[model samples]
Target: MNPLNLPFDSDAMLEGLRPWIECESPTWDAGAVSRMMALAARDLADAGAEVETIPGTGGFGDSLRASFPHPDRGRPGILVSGHMDTVHPVGTLEKLPFRVEDRLAYGPGIMDMKGGNYVMLEAMRQILRAGLQTPLPVTFLFTPDEEVGTPATRGLIEDAARGQRAVLVPEPASADGGAVIGRYAIARFELLTEGRPSHAGWALKDGRSAIAAMARKILEIEAMTTEDCTFSVGVIHAGQWVNCVSSECRAEVLSMAKTQADLDRGVAAMEALQGEADGVAFTVTRGVTRPVWEPGPGTMQLYDLAKGLAADIGFQLGCGSAGGGSDGNFTGAMGVPTLDSIGVRGKGLHTLTEHIEIDSLAERARLAAGLLMNIR
Candidate 1:
């Protein structure tokens, strides 16, 4: 079934998508995420999907699995994977409320993912409404924690992808409307500095300021950025009183590498970092990591299929490696054919100006629906 022949009203899709964007499911807010999951569950159930709710662990919100029945239900089939979390906080709605301006639908998480999720759901609904079924069984996995990395759901994502025919990730499309065939390796680090505190007014020379040491370390870390790898310090906290030298400081670091070898060297360098001055102690703790996923023949084949489908729908779809990581990293690294970032076309992700091209509502949905019907 060619989904393009079916009626897809962009305005109606925008309205259907408004509630999802308005829900505000930030990763840190478990209750808000749960509410968003509930909304999705209801929609999937209404569309004739067998929905399963996985209780969240480690204080994250619940994940969801919605399956569409087919003759090949028991076999490995398509996995439509994405996240329900956003980086924006709870009160962001007051600042960036849902609105359509000049053919762009603006809201927190609208372009990053909610728009893509809604489009996929609408595609499924349209297929079912037309009395059609995909060649293979379809399963949708919605995760609750992705903005801070999939620390809570990595195992679940891998388990779901195991033995699947393919994994499709509807992360935000690239700036030029390209899909992701490969993703860079990513590692997170937590740094801490400890020093001796003394009165800033009288005993300044006796004080060893942790903040000063951390500032130097931050510069050193950022200076490590090269063509192969990049480092950034995104968070920092220190000092409690103005009259006393800081005794402790902490920061979060993120590093991205084009290859595993480069990332390994970067990790080793980070672990070997030392304090900038005497009497200050520095420490680095490794956190979540995403292994690099280089495009394989299987992934290339999937991209070829998607590219052809896009051409039939009157758009030229491009494919390449992207910087940020997604659940596709797990599946693609495991050698499963994976396609990432086949979502809405838009810009300003992770900011108050986040939004999607209103016209992409129908265009991308057609692309998604085509993949569902054509992928065996």
Candidate 2:
């Protein structure tokens, strides 16, 4: 029952990768993402899989959920996960078309994940062709907007994963080329302040400056962070000019908490800023983009299963955790055993230098197929 018997065309996989890279499908650009999903869905459905396009939360690309029943497997399933949205913004394609030189292919989202999506697609195709009976069923979720925050699609991912045996995320390979097993929780906050404006020279003493108050709050927020619980004042917008005391100022914070207690403490510190300034009004919006994922009961078992499967296929596997976040964090947080960075090994991700290892495609595809074969 070698899963490598599954039908796979390296040429087809390469074909899929080219268009994905040539198109600039950023998280917010729903149109391009939709087209990509449709193509993937059409191909997947033709291969005896049920497919559904989950509409996004009023954005450019929604999510695509597809399931392939094993020849004789029953209920419990394994989900292969990835995101469609990339960090590339609009017009990036023209700036950086897909290029190949010296065994490297560079483009917008190739390694970050487009190539991983291809790996999944080709692996599934090969499995179906082989007519193998897997021990468990397989589900694939391609979410949009993962590059940004997965605010619009978190619930969908959780719902698909409920009662599943485990979930696998194909984020890019680690810098050390090892697979990732854990990730940090992400919290983003917006700080807005409002104050009455007055002439800088004539009535400066009477008006409270929103920008000054905002600056002080930013400093306090920074001081609240630690080595494990990190924080950054990411974006700030405020004030008009020097002629008048500014009436409004806004700042955004991106915080990463290492543990549940750290998250609670960070949130409390963020909320505490609301009443710090007397005359200036303040508001805060908080979002936990992804939850922290560490080795636990469900996850450790899942890792052992995946590692065992990889060993059977002759691929030595290693695992590590990361400070960044992903949808894997969401399911892993919900108590599902989760493993990430199962995609093709690659060097650069989310940059113009992004590329997937051409040689790893076949091996990783076989690895994915084998993992799916042992899902239950």
Most accurate candidate by TM-score: 1
Model 2, position 102: C-alpha lDDT score: 73
Q: Check candidate 2 and list the clashing pairs.
A: 6-126, 7-126, 30-60, 30-61
TM-score against native, each model: 0.98, 0.87
In the range 1-376, model 1's lDDT, one tens digit per residue, is 4666778888999998899999999999999999999999999999889999999998999999999878888689999999999999999999999988999989999998999988889888899999898988899999999888799999999988999888999998898899999999989999999999999999999999999999999999999999899999999999989999999999999999999999999999999995445999999999999999999998998999999999999999999998888888889999999999999999999998998999998999999999988888
Displacement of residue 103 (Cα, Å) in model 2 is 1.8
Model 2 worst lDDT run, 10 consecutive residues: 4-13
What TM-score, to 2 decimals, does candidate 2 have? 0.87
Residue 39's lDDT within candidate 1 is 95
Give lDDT for model 2: 0.79
lDDT of each: 0.92, 0.79
- The candidate scoring highest on lDDT is 1
N/CA/C clash count, model 1: 0
